[model samples]
Target: MPPMRKWTINGDFLTLSPNGVARYGREVTLAIDDLLAAGGPLADGLEVTLATPVGGHDLPLRHIRTVHVPEFRRPRLPQVWVQLQLPRHVQGGLLSFCNLAPVAVSRQIVCMHDAHTWLMPESYDRMFRLAHRVIMPVLGRRARAVATVSHHARRQLAALGVAREDRIAVAWNGCDHALRWRASRSPRDYRNRRPFVLCIGRNQPYKNMELIWAMAPALAARGVEVLVAGEAGGAGALRHGPNVVALGRISDDELAAAMEAALCFVFPTRIEGFGLPAAEAMARGCPVIASTADALMEVCGDAAIHVDPDDVNGWTAAVIRLLENPFERLAMVAAGRARARLFTWRGVAETWLGLMAAADGVPVQAPGGRGAASAAPIVAGA
Candidate 1:
């Protein structure tokens, strides 16, 4: 029998607004919970608890326990809570899904999704960027292990001197959650009178929303509309034509509906840890015309029509091609669904379990039947 192992999950993400990182945390936690419930070699002698700050969302979990830690009123409540109070409640190994983790917890594994703060400084505020710059390196060096969403992210993290490449594991984000999004149940009618190419993201500079806005005129000339979703922070400054519709901050169902009705989902991100939005669109059966960014290429593979982020003409051409060719669209949808299947929450959870077991100095078989050593980084789907 394996020796008993106790691990605590840093559920700080539950308290924050739902984004890619928060979505990763939630989906991975649920996957881990499901795995624990279905006892196996991975679950043997393993105990997990989710520790969150007070007022975090209550997740319907079985087999794993949830504990709320009270926080002291501080300037940065979330950061202070995780750094000071959350560490005190950890039973053994701490698993933090989001980027930041307590530096004091030496026996912790943190999932630093990306080095975006350093890579794309313009997208983040000074304080947010500064905090990540200071904290990530500390956690990278101090934490027992580190996990990232993609090989591209792992490379970026290492190149930025955040962590050693050997210390970082790659666990790609799952796309199965998008499959659950009910397009038919969407509250808003996303089916615009004219066929639209859908784009989603905040107005962050690295998101490269400007490329889409630039191409809108050419696309609109072809009788197609450009639908921009998510927070339109600098909507006033956007140079889009009248055909560009800003659907600010939509729900998952609404996004699903938009994708289903759209000509193709366009993601022109300049950089990414893993392009979760493109992967999600693929899973939802929407053809993707994504950027040629390293992470996007890695995640989308040949499933998407890759275009340079700065190529306004190229993006416009791809959208038009998909709009004109029904056969090409159908082929892409099939290929995308197949590619999206490669990433799974259960697979990610298994990788996490393997990492935990190895961290505990226990020799265990990883998801692909490879032996996990304490010092070796485990890449999911490797």
Candidate 2:
């Protein structure tokens, strides 16, 4: 029998909020777990365990192995811990997803979600931005491999001097969460008594929140409410325009309900790494009216009515056209569901496995066409 392999996943995200990165980390690990259970690749397979600086007891996975690092427990000292302490504990190759990896850990795969800190600096705090600007370049060059969520992000990373063009790989986000929620009977938290268009709240201008707000009065006149699901605080979430209702801090099931029931899931973000929400919406059979953001284009493909993020008029027209043409909306919903199926955690796990195999000097092929080895897209474009 061949020797068994071992790897450690950076489980710091367990302590953070259930944001996109944490969700990605959890879903990908779970998919890998499922794959291993079925005896996929690496016949002398990995003995994978998640390692964390603090509490990771709440994660659904059974592989968590917590480690104590007093300095790492504090929010402000994360960088210090990663740079100065994490290397000491990584017994084998480390898989550091969600944007930070130990600089000293050469046998590492660092998944940088996006170059957001550079693209949308105003959206983050000064310290956070500064740390990423400093940390990513070093990690990009030092780590054995660097991965990102989208091609746009891979391009931006190179442009921002974070990673060399040849150094990064793409690992797309999966849409299975949407599929799960769609079939589940979880509570539907959104109150959309009227037919509505949905826009998720990101308290930043680049998300083109202003466009959603701007078109509110017109949408209301058409008996269409503009439902904005936002962060916890309703009032502080966004500038509430006419007919806009804020459904704040919802559960996955509720979000799925909103996406499933919405007339059109509208995403007009000016910039994004991988537009997960839009794909999730599409997976739930909702037609989408998305922005021309590069990542949105990649995720939504021809399944969406792609408009200029800044074009309030174009968004308004698309909404009206969809509301008026149920046939077109139905066609779009069908197209979107097909498009959404392309991004799966299974694919990500397969791709990571491919990367791991490559690292071990064993060239392996990933499952889906969207895997790192192929030129296929995360979604089929028109």
Candidate 3:
């Protein structure tokens, strides 16, 4: 009989990149590790370790055990590392949070965040787009279970042509990090007297960075500044109008300061697995103006001023309206904070571990919806 599956997580994403996907892996893993240390009902019979290739990045592994596979340290083709090498090295069940899971592992769980490559093909490299198209469907089909960050993503997963679409279930991401890192003790001492609008995250194609830039001219006319922050592919790459200040890769505290000081937070992304920045901004009590498409609608819900991403006029109008109307902005802030309170790291860890256990053939004792921590229902304010 196949050695009674020992639980292991694919840790390649941790070492390879520190993108949004990798950050999710770290945040959720740490939260789970903390819960396991606390020794709850969910901890029983759960023997999970992070099986990883060697890398420079170090995680706070206080409660998490990690096994280093030395051969995988020097990187080769990532697919080969995952498909062939990882499976050969790791024994027992696998829980892969970042998209791909080894096909050879019969009992495994993979988190399919979104059908991004399908939704925005131009965003990725040619080789990556081709590989994802070929690989994702197979990963979805063969894996014992697939989890997505949002309910909206499950619908997108259906388009991937996976046979077991029924296995696609909701395992949402958390925004507690926003709470932890939010501007504290006087909103980071806002120095700017001018009212500003905030936009965060990288200048990726799907992010619709140009739309944020495009709004600058109109926003400047109304005496509002646009503070664009995040990985702009390196300094000096982005061009903004007279009103825009492109802050590249700011500290969380700085981001929080920006959010707290802003008149409104804008996210005009064409697509997202979950629009984390909007959620992050909401958690900070910043008024948000975000796109209605994909996961943003599910995430922001009634809290934000929703706009069609392609409608430049609509986006401008939303910002203009929010900045001018204090009642609307205050309403968004109150609703947004209440909405953000719904997603917690502790809840995320509980839900994910419950799902992982079920996937690994362990009997799950958690509640039906989104696992144990979800018992505290997300009560959105009116």
Candidate 4:
């Protein structure tokens, strides 16, 4: 009886590395580690499908199940297909299950990263949006429990009537080993030979880069150049010639180096369920400047400079103020580090344990005062 497997991990996401590199890929590949770190009966019986190109080479052969499917395709169709197949292959063998994508299965748990499909419909093709909209609601209704990365996402899911409030759980994201490794390096050597403010993520419209670009003159006034990392989604080259250093796609170490050297991390996104890069920068002790979305505030706490993403003048003014005020910048950096300390993989694992236990009809303790210490601090004048 498969040695009473408590969890079976899907690793197809890791297999498509070149594509993963293209897409703003992060945690989908690290799901196995997250499962292992929870430290329960589940860890001992963990089994994973070996598909990651580089990492899979050394994994034990007996553990791998070669699910023959095209590993790469446009719009992540291959992953979608494989995720759909996992339910049948692992059905009856597990006491609990977790999928990173929408799937039909039992004793199931799924973590949907964001509802960007609704926010930025133009970023994806109609077919992709249709598939997601049609399938996710069904997946939400069928799953035993649902997990998300932010409270804003929880509210969005509830408003959509996607799932019951109790069934939906919030598991904040973590800063992985990569960021930690970079944190140990020298700031001058790591970041380019100049002081700059960093902005990370896809240069898509909903991310509100246009607003950031408009604020560039203001950022330049503070003697801080704006550096952007990640792919540019839409056509026609982005503006801000010499003032902005556009590092299109870079290695993990390079990204880490950039974050470490940054004067501050700025992210004035119009919408996001969880702000990964902003939180990551804070975890590495860099102050963050982001929009005042409920989700952004929730993740950043009192450690960030908040701005109205749509208000061009306001965003510009905030960037300029942070750059000029050395004392305020240092204070925010210290506060950001403290705020980031509260979010860790261990905490996320505990939240998952409680949610999964509740789903399994196990009498789990309620989340009383669990994350109270880390809730966002109040800002003066709203």
Candidate 5:
């Protein structure tokens, strides 16, 4: 029998609100569970457990154990638990999918999804930024390994002095979850609705939602409405216009339907770790007009019509062109689905397994004999 390998996943994300980071953690965890159940060399003698705070949500995992750590009642309980208490319950190695991790854990891998706290400081509140600015660098230096979602993000982390370039591994986020969404069961009936362009993101400054607001009038003039999803807080002020529908937070099924039926999906974010929404849009066969941000460019590649985030005119033109041109739209949808296929949850899990094994000083190779120490290479144009 192979030697026993024990690892605990930090389940802090399960207690947080659903977002890109949380989604990545949840999906990757599930994928890892699926891989273990499938049985393979990587899964051999591997014992995984998800350690969460007492009230964290549960996941349907087959091959991994789940434990809830008792937390001391305190301010910032989640942060406190992860940094102080959770580590006490861990046995061998730790895996943190979210950006924050126990800085003291030397035999661990923390997936810092982005360098947003440093690069896009204004997007986050002061305390949040300061916390990350301090904690991330420490984790980068102390952890056995670091992982990020995109090559662009990996470069950003290294450039910002968060981690050495060599210490970071790139594990791209998967889009296959969108494929599981049942568009037919979408709650909204779109058959009689006006032709609309769909946009989804929080109302953060870096999300560049203002650009969409600025172009809403022009899109409406062309008899196209704008459907916005996932906005909260101050975005309610922008929800007044008839041409713009603020779908403040929606189910995946609803989003899948919106993407499938929309004229196109527009993502004008100023920065991104992996541009997950755009990737998910592509996975749903939705043509995308995305920003030329480095990560977006890398993820969307030739699959999307790229535009400057601040270019209102360019965004308007792209949306209009896609609406009027069936051939171009069809071609783009085909390209997008093809591109999205290159990213899979299984691939990401494989990368994480390799990183974990390598970090633990185990001699393991990926299915293709790639050294476990070197993560999966970035997919072409991904």
Candidate 6:
């Protein structure tokens, strides 16, 4: 049997309250659940001692060694001193974990989700950019093994000079079960309402809502209403159309209903690590028209219509072409559903388990050792 390993997960995301901040909290949650679920010869003696940031819900009270780190703006450095407060093995050290925080122990695994701040600097604040530039690589290079969500991020990490190519693993994010469950449930009857293209996410510069709005009039001219969902901001430039409906901060049920009922799901993001909305829409059986960007292509694969987000006419043409062609729309919806099946938390969890095994020097078994066989397969766009 492989020796039982000890892991210390950095639960920074869990420490923050969900204050309408659309960040990557759920990813941490999924990772925890997956680690626990993937128990066996490798997982039996494996014990996880989570070092969470201060002031949040304490998770799995029995298995956690909660450490209070100051917020990102003010991080406490002496993590070993903090670990001394715990009753368990303080000097045992972390075998592997995610994030790039200062750990007293070595043999760590750090997963940087993406470098969205680097790509879309104007979307984030100055403090965030400064932190990303300074801290992320330090954590990345120091860790024993590094992981990221996409190939795009791997390339970005390489550019940042964090980890060697061989040490880096790509673990893709999963489609939310909320999306899948909602997709399975029948949408509330709203057929009488005008057919509309659905747009999700906050009205941020990176989201490229401005470009989507530019094509709205053309879509409306062809009798397609545009439903805009998510928070609004930045210069107060909200898209207004006779056929436009802005529904802000909807429940998952409503989002699934909207996806099912829409003419199609339209995402015009300029940059992304992984396009969750595109996958969510695809899983919920909706045809997606996404921006022709690295992350979007990685997520949507060939299951979506690629549109140049900056080109108004190209956006209008893609939306219009799908709007008129029922066959093409149906084909995309089917393809999307099939493609979405490839992504799941269970699969991701198993991959993580194997990585942990590899890090332990245990001969990892076949059918799962392949770094990304568990990942959502990338169907490259033409």
The lDDT of each candidate is 0.85, 0.77, 0.76, 0.61, 0.85, 0.65
Predicted structure 3: lDDT? 0.76
Model 3 steric clash pairs: none
The total number of steric clashes, by the backbone 3 Å criterion, in model 3 comes to 0
Native-to-model Cα distance after best TM-score fit, residue 88 in candidate 1, in Å: 0.5
lDDT of 5 by residue, 219-278 (tens): 878998888888632356345356888777888898998888888999889999998999
Question: What's the CA error at residue 368 for candidate 4, in Å?
Answer: 6.2
Q: Alpha-carbon error at 376 in model 1, in Å?
A: 28
Q: Write the per-residue lDDT of candidate 6 for residues 1-382, one digit (tens) a residue.
A: 7455766655544545432212333444455555566546545566666655566466544433556544433454333322333223332334333344554435666667777777778887887677666666776666667777677778877776766766777766667564535534444544567778888858568888787667768877888887877775323324355666667666677788888888889888887767778878888888898888877777677788887778788777877777788898899889888778776655555666666667777677632421232334322132
A best-first ranking of the candidates according to their TM-score comes to 1, 5, 2, 3, 6, 4
Residue 44, candidate 1: alpha-carbon lDDT: 84
Assess candidate 4 and give its lDDT.
0.61
Q: After superposing candidate 2 on the true structure, give the runs of residues whose Cα lies further than 4 Å from its correct spot.
A: 62-76, 182-192, 236-239, 366-368, 371-382
TM-score of the candidate numbered 5? 0.93
lDDT of 1 by residue, 131-223 (tens): 899999999999999999988899999999999999998877888998888988988886756798888858689999788778888987898
Q: What is the TM-score of each candidate against the true structure?
A: 0.93, 0.90, 0.88, 0.79, 0.93, 0.80
- Model 4 misplaced stretches (Cα beyond 4 Å): 1-5, 16-80, 91-102, 176-178, 183-192, 233-238, 367-382
* Worst-scoring 10-residue span by lDDT in model 3: 373-382
After TM-score superposition, the amount by which residue 33's alpha carbon in candidate 4 deviates from its true location, in angstroms, is: 5.0
Q: Return the clash pairs for model 1, or none.
A: none
- Residue 49 lDDT (model 4): 43
